[model samples]
Target: MSAARPAGPVGGVTGCVFPPATEARLAPARRIADAVLFEGYVLYPYRASAAKNRLRWQFGVLVPPGYGRDSGEHSHQRTECLLEPRGPGGHLAVELRFLRARRRTVQRAAAPGPDAYLTVPELELSDRVLTPWDEGVPESVRLLLPLERLTRPEGVEHPFLLPARRETEPVTEKGAPVGRLRYATEEVSGVLRLRARELPGPYGALRLTAVVANTGGWTAPPAGADRADALPHSLLSAHLLLALDRGRFLSATDPPRWAAPAVAECAGEHTWPVLADPEGGDDVLLSSPIILEDHPRIAPESPAALYDATEIDEILALRTACLTDREMREARGTDARAGAVVDFAASLPPEVLERLHGAVRSLREVSPVPGAADASGEQPWWDPGADRGVDPARDTVAVGGVAVGAGSRVLLRPGRRRTDAQDLFLDGRTALVEAVLHDVDGSVHLAVTVEDDPGADLWRAQGRFRYFQPDEVTPLEAS
Candidate 1:
């Protein structure tokens, strides 16, 4: 993979291959990428019998076209990113990564014969419990494309395949063979199409579009076939890592004002590209099926991948710590990764747990107020109630020539700028204003509840209500 080489389509390349010197170059990005790759590989409680664990592969699943077409799952993902190449001999290295699901079936000998075995959902051995599980085998396809070749009208198309595999592992009970695990996976085929075109902007930026599709042959499943049936032939957690030889890639989420228009034109389907270099370089871009912000990272305090990325590490650790001995055993027996998570959670010291409790990502310097701090001398800015200038309950905003405040009545008329589609249904509905709120930006909002809704009282009791801007409501006459 050389930048000086002429542009041409490279095919039949399979494996986790990184450009020269890029393995270390992409280390930081790979850490976050690994988290994304196995975002939901397994859930907390980690036991195969857990309800949440039953339905797996929630993210970045590119199922067979035949199954996806009818099931609403996707068969492909597309990503578009902007880049500025400093030289004509520049090149792009793309690594397409995904998981291949392997179905493991537990089997027990029926009559002590070598070939005679009875399939079972689970087999309890002397040492552990064996349950039928679907495991993900990491797979990747690497490609190096010349930027000059991508500029061609026809672009470049590369096809790749992951061959089928089958294996068996014997399970023993005190050195005696009791059962075995049969693992099988179907062949998965996919193609990547990359095209680059010059943008109309003065920045001389180039837009690169990469589309990855699952072209594996699949027979339409039976009427009752579920995701588990189609999963073995699917690409789980499909994502791409793109590295530039000698250019910088612009942020698609937060581009500079001058490049805003060009960034707006960038589009994607089931895929989003974000700047990946943790040091703030723009040479590496991570295109993921999971939408992520620029330079997304795993928290340093996070001890391990809990599969529930949305959960706080402290909370997960605490929850895992409280699991029953039987539950822990079940989790440990479910999969090797699950066993590792269990061990990791149990080994955290008090100080490590405290660190995982929380960390303030950033803070702003607040000017000292004469009487802001108490005897403790801690900053009062941490407490919102410390600020006495604002009161939501007493705030008032003029609407339709009326001073609308708490306990006022208004008719909702959601404006075209409405943020939620449900707001349209509230249009022309009578609502009781609970409070007039002012945001930090000095914008006024009227929090109200539908007067006729049966849950109006409950909503007020819970302090939950819909909010509308000053112009989105009209003051009604007092009854």
Candidate 2:
């Protein structure tokens, strides 16, 4: 559900794929799942005119059958996960969640007559600002099934349809209607299919596959039509939630040695499955369109969901708090959720803002060095700069039978593993080495500035240099 799409192909078949669980059982995971649900629903400086906002719905988009090929988006997505059931008797509650697109257009009228209406991009009623934009409505389809039912050779299939509709809300001045907003949506149809097969491992593991597809009956857009024209017929940010009565799901990402083989055999298209329970139990698995680690949880220090999960709360909050009145008004008019973010940022107390500044999620004991302590006593373990033994300027690394350190010269030969695209242009260029550094993991790196670069002196003065592994460069001379 982010603006940046993950690299992969998408596929689908649908129904309940997990066992039945009570509301209380789902409450914890539901909170984290909601964050995933609206990960990029809106962004900072939220406005309909923003370029980023115009290209929305980048994750788990399921366009109608024939339209996918034309639009370069998939109509379905599949989730393949490994489960180690404790016994043969087990049940699963499957919940499919996604968003349906709603197209809202502002309209104006000179008088209260049907023929007097004229389409407009925006309109103001009193202090309220209205603008034309796309909005998402949440939808969920769920089912529960016995483990035996899913074991059948044919598996199980369930088809569903969300009917289409059109709505009109009046814009009023005093008691009379002045203008109206028209909301239109298209019918969405999809099917869910679930199947389970036993693995060859000693751990009685089973590979479970769940597929969700878009079967909506909509014609493909014409040759020149863009994705915006097909949004109404698509399922936005689709993902699955599964709860089990008995059985533990092995992590597909970090499975035990024995189950690794089976995990490799499991095929997943577009979506990935990870353990969902924040408490570390494996009974729940979230098959999301966006990749996530096992037992993912939101930080408690966060005050609100800003729709950009990858960004830091402190930076986003500060940026939102600094928005001018005009920008705030446009953001408030963009969507109700955007308006809430603006209000939350403006109302944050000093203490609450400080909390968002930072938090320590973990701490570890460090073994003291004989001479690590001084007059001020032992340095704080969190301060890496306190280590007096390390000096980048005096450090040396062996490259091509030469000691390369500060003031050394080298030929830039960046390796095949292209970490940055700009590295391609730097290959074969000469550079002046600024430092030989060792990371916390004990890997050596050379920091250098391009010899021919106009800003080389400025970069060297600011202590900023491009970094490369020892194997990526050949030493030419040592200063």
Best by lDDT: 1
Consecutive 10-residue window with the lowest summed lDDT within model 1:
1-10
- Point to the candidate with the largest TM-score: 2
Residue-by-residue lDDT tens digits, candidate 2, 11-60: 13244433235455666777767777788878777777788788898888
Model 2: how far residue 214 lies from native, Å: 0.3
| Residue 268 alpha-carbon offset, candidate 2, angstroms | 0.4
Alpha-carbon TM-score of each model against the true structure = 0.75, 0.75
Q: 331-387, model 1: which lDDT tens digit per residue?
A: 776877777777778888998888876778686555466437655766454455666
Model 2 has how many clashing residue pairs?
A: 18
TM-score of 2: 0.75
Q: What is the lDDT of residue 8 in candidate 2?
A: 13
